[model samples]
Each structure stands twice: as C-alpha cells, then as structure tokens.
Target: MPSLDTAKAYYEYFNQKNWDGMISLLHPEVRHEPNQGEPRIGLELFKAFMQHMDESYEETLTDMVFFTEPNDERVAVEFVVNGIYKKAEEGLPAAHNQKYVLPAAAFLGFTDGKISRITTYYNLPLWIKLVSE
Candidate 1:
C-alpha cells in the first residue's frame, strides 16, 4: 500500500470525479453512514451512490478544506463540499436544479489500507434550499 497523501491525491481524485478510483480505495465490506438514517453498505451501494452523484451534480469540489486524523487503523476527514447542483438524485425532491454549495464531512475507518467504514455529515436544509431555488 502507498502512503496516502491526504490533501493532494485524495481531493484531486475527488475533484476529478474519479468515482472508480475513489471506490478502489475502499474495502469490500465498506459501509457508509451519512447520518442517523439508513446506512449504505458494500460495493453495490457505493456504486449506487456514485451513480447518483454522476446523475445529480455537474460540478466539482470548490472552496474545499480538509482536516484529517489518521492512525494505523483509520482516517477521519471533515471538509466543506461547495459546488453547484446541476442535477438531482432519486428519493430527493426536485430541488437540485439550482446552484448551491454545501458543507459535508466524511469519517473513514481503515483496515489493511482500505476504508472499511465511513460516516458522512452534511446540512440537509442547506442542500434542500439550494436545490429548491
């Protein structure tokens, strides 16, 4: 495994919208919990999330800053994902038509150089307002 460069490679990959590359960095049994709601687990769900992103946004991370804490087992990153919403994902109201930048955070737990778990945080009201506008 390579020594992960927190700000450079990671965000660069993200800003480029390289979902496959992003997914490749995750563990097979990875789980992503964005909040207290349902949790998305495994590669299948992860792919679905990527698909949603592809269909929903026509932009990249802007005004982004990262704060990471990594040890032998995990890496926690909190960031502000500022971007315009050019598309909408399913199950979400038709509010993603306008431009809005939202802040989000992801806390990742790693094992064997792969992300085994991830928890994401974001402001739903801000997102909703942006999309609805």
Candidate 2:
C-alpha cells in the first residue's frame, strides 16, 4: 500500500491507452469486475479486458480524484469518463460511432504493491442517454 502516486500512475496508464503497460502494475492473480457483468481474473484476462476497451472506445477519465482507505490498502476513485465509440461497445444501447460521458466509481484493492482486485460501477442510464443521443 503506497500513496496517491501509485494510484495516479494507474490512471495515467489507462488515460494513455496503455493496456499492456497497465497490466504490469497488477498482480498475477488480480481480479476485475466492471459493473458486475463478469469477473475477469488473472493478468491475462485483465489485459484482454483492457484490450477490448481500447478497441471499443476512445475515452478519457476527467476530473478524477482518489481517496485512499486506511493503510492505503484500498482506494475509491471517482471520475467522469468520456468516450466516443468507434466500434460498438459490448453493452452499449446503440450501434456505433456514439459519444458518451458517464460518472463512474471504482474500488481498487492492493497487495504487494500492485492491484489485487478492482470493481467499477457507473450510471447505466446516464451512459445510455449520452451514447444514444
């Protein structure tokens, strides 16, 4: 459990669209659940998930802030993520080439200086409304 530096680095990696680079900051057995669709466990699956996101949207997290829990073992991040879909996103309400900005929250759990688990939640209705507009 470090400080905001590590957390900021993680976001920077994501913002840069560096999927593989971000993977290096996770543990081998890291687990990720994005808005409860399905849990992706292990480094390979997590990388795959990021790859899917990279392929689906041109997005960035703006106005982001991180709140680290006690001992810095967990972090709660709040941000507004904006994306323009070039390829249809898996759960999107529309076909393609849509733009969206959604408020999102994510919990990150860490161990041994890397992320062990992450859970993300977002406003679905807001996402739909924006992307489908």
Identify the candidate with maximal lDDT: 2
- Candidate 1 lDDT, tens digit per residue, 1-133? 6324533455577888887778878789889887657999898998897787677776566555545455546555666666666665567666435766777776667666777787878888777776776
**Candidate 2 lDDT, tens digit per residue, 1-133?**
3846677888998998777667878889998988957898998888777777777779899999899866878888999988887776556575577877788988888888988888999987777788777
Once superposed on the true structure, which residue ranges of model 1 sit more than 4 Å away at CA?
1-8, 63-65, 68-70, 89-91
Clashes of 1: 1
In candidate 2, how many Å is residue 132 off? 1.3
Structure candidate 1, residue pairs in collision: 95-131
lDDT for 108 in candidate 2 is: 88
Q: Considering summed lDDT, which 10 consecutive residues are worst modelled in model 2? A: 86-95
**Ten residues in a row with the worst lDDT in model 1?**
2-11
Report, for every candidate in turn, its global Cα lDDT versus the true structure.
0.69, 0.82
